[model samples]
Target: MTAERTRALQERFGNALMPTYGVPPVAIARGEGARVWDVDGRPYLDLIGGIAVSALGHGHPALVKAVADQTAALAHTSNLFLHEREVELAERLIALLGDPGARVFLANSGTEANEAALKLARKAAGPARPVLVATENGFHGRSLGALAVTGKESMRAPFGPYGTEVRFVPHGDAGALRAAVDDTVAAVIVEPVQGEAGVVPAPDGYLAAVREICDAAGAAFVLDEIQSGIGRTGHWFAHQAQGVRPDVLTLAKGLGGGLPIGACVGFGRYATAFAKGDHGSTFGGNPVAAAAALAVLDTVENEDLLGSAARTGAALAEGMRATGHPLVAGVRGTGLWLALVLTAERAAEVQARAADHGFLINAVAPDALRLAPPLTLTPEQAASFTGALPAILDEVNP
Candidate 1:
């Protein structure tokens, strides 16, 4: 939080890294629990949780031990060889899906997981079905195949010609989604909560409707739960609330805590769609990452974080709304991944001021502030930010 530490990180980042993400303002030296210290030793409560990662918080002992133990034993072995860690992690993810017959493909990141699911759906649908349906403002990933399913044109138009026939429909619009899925459709991809779009949840019945549509059309139903999975939404998978099981599911973010890992799962008949020679990833399902992910899952269950996320998240949202600050228009989304909708275009200013006050939040949209604090975030930590939010908004209100 100190000006000196912020400048130091910004300078190094501008000079050393690519211009893709631009220069970030703050530099974190280390983190423990729900708080992080800057390079200059000033502390800030990390409410963004590394864009919804860090489910067990920073430097959790279980996750650290798992990574260290697995690394000391073995790290990498391509899919050409057998590894217990990969199989074990895969089994755990499928079990979370409530489908023991499901199959899984591990990847290094969410986008790769999504890419794998896209290819699997395409292969399962055969050559005649070329159309893929995605929601407007829905974000899947940045890889070409994932990008094709993502509805943001600005990000996708620059990368075309995208190598697929993907159609965009309004998110949560049942009629549009139903009309779009046909026999020629290969898959229908949607996010349970549109995290990139300020944590906007689809209407209550939208997911179930999409599942029915995909089923009737014989198209694969894919749910991208990268940001909302692994206990972030107080559920193993966000789509579970709708009581609809997707044909394929993509997950990442908090799955491996701070480590890099992702999973693409297939259920029912779709599980056997991929042939041995059809697809693969050399570094996917490595021991270290798998162990990290397993530890995250174990800690979430052992510590009862899923319950904590729901309870703490509800209290925090209520506290913020109770502030009755002029900028506080409303709050929405689920678990710890809620968004504070602002009445004015002061979200960027609020974000900066909140950081100055030792709180790390994200201005996910011009009028919305996103909070994805660690699932282990205690009531006291939530109160800290919620208590300071009124002043933060006031300081930026002009």
Candidate 2:
């Protein structure tokens, strides 16, 4: 069944879809917890967790019920008429962050949430202060507004004439950030953890330094936690661990579990920047999406998945480190968010071999393999992967 589906999909959709992603042709039919069975009846432990989007895993009962109930009752009512779910979700998110008075603008993806954050920062800065500073190797999104601030030259080079006057500063360099962001700057956008940059975390005191600089310059501090938030890092929001609060925070990826949802949260003074018609989205806060996000939150809290992620992740990291596998240079990151740096250019081979061993991982870069399994992953599952790691590394290296 899987092979047939794969063949049919490739034949009918050959090159029709964008070529951004390579072809693997795994026909996934259903998923539960941390395991997914391909159409061919092959079960694989999902470690990427849909690129860190499936916080509650696939087809979770709570999430399914939330979507079903909300869609039947009120799927969408447009932005003109307010719905209860949007308000409820916003309140829940703000409360989760421990910031009650924060205001939220909903969107459908991390990039869109970031787009809204960029707009809010620009609006708050006025015409005189139009410059935005972003960290190198940081990724915001692909939209023109978000793309302008993304620091990857490879991605930005193709999209010339970007809309914003953005400056790129070195990640984890507070002195450079302070120098770049001044009174003339509108905002300094940063990622608490550089997810796409192979799970590079900000240096100690870096976020706080950025906060201080932004405050001194009267610029908005926008923290992009799209991939690091929602308990991926064992924290409701990664920035919370750093004891720094940003003027604006963007969230998505894992927010809706497997469903699509994004939010731009503004705090205190930044909250009031978007008044009346400043910005809007047609399906930003649709009831179904909000319900899904709520379900994800509920599952994380009720099941104590945050604590699980921390414990399991620590164990996995320790085991990987113990291997002393020459190919494995080191392990970095916290909670379920981790990356293994390889000494050679065999990360892709390791990923493919791991798949053959019924484990799915991501070779995010040539020398980096990223792992963000479902928060509900069991100790047995973690052991299974770590136990197989030495052999996988041997296969790749030998």
Candidate 1 residue-wise lDDT, 175-223, digit = tens? 9999888899999999988988888988889888998899898999999
Q: Supply every candidate's count of residue pairs whose N, Cα or C atoms clash at under 3 angstroms.
A: 0, 0
TM-score of each: 0.98, 0.97
Lowest summed lDDT over 10 consecutive residues: which window, candidate 2?
Answer: 1-10
Residues 6-32, model 2: lDDT tens digits: 677666665677666656656577899
| Cα distance off (Å), candidate 2, residue 248 | 0.2
Which residue runs of candidate 1 sit more than 4 Å off their true CA positions?
Answer: none
Candidate models: Cα lDDT each: 0.90, 0.90
lDDT of model 1, residue 390? 84
Clashing pairs in 2: none
Off by over 4 Å in 2: 1-4
Which pairs clash in the backbone of model 1? none
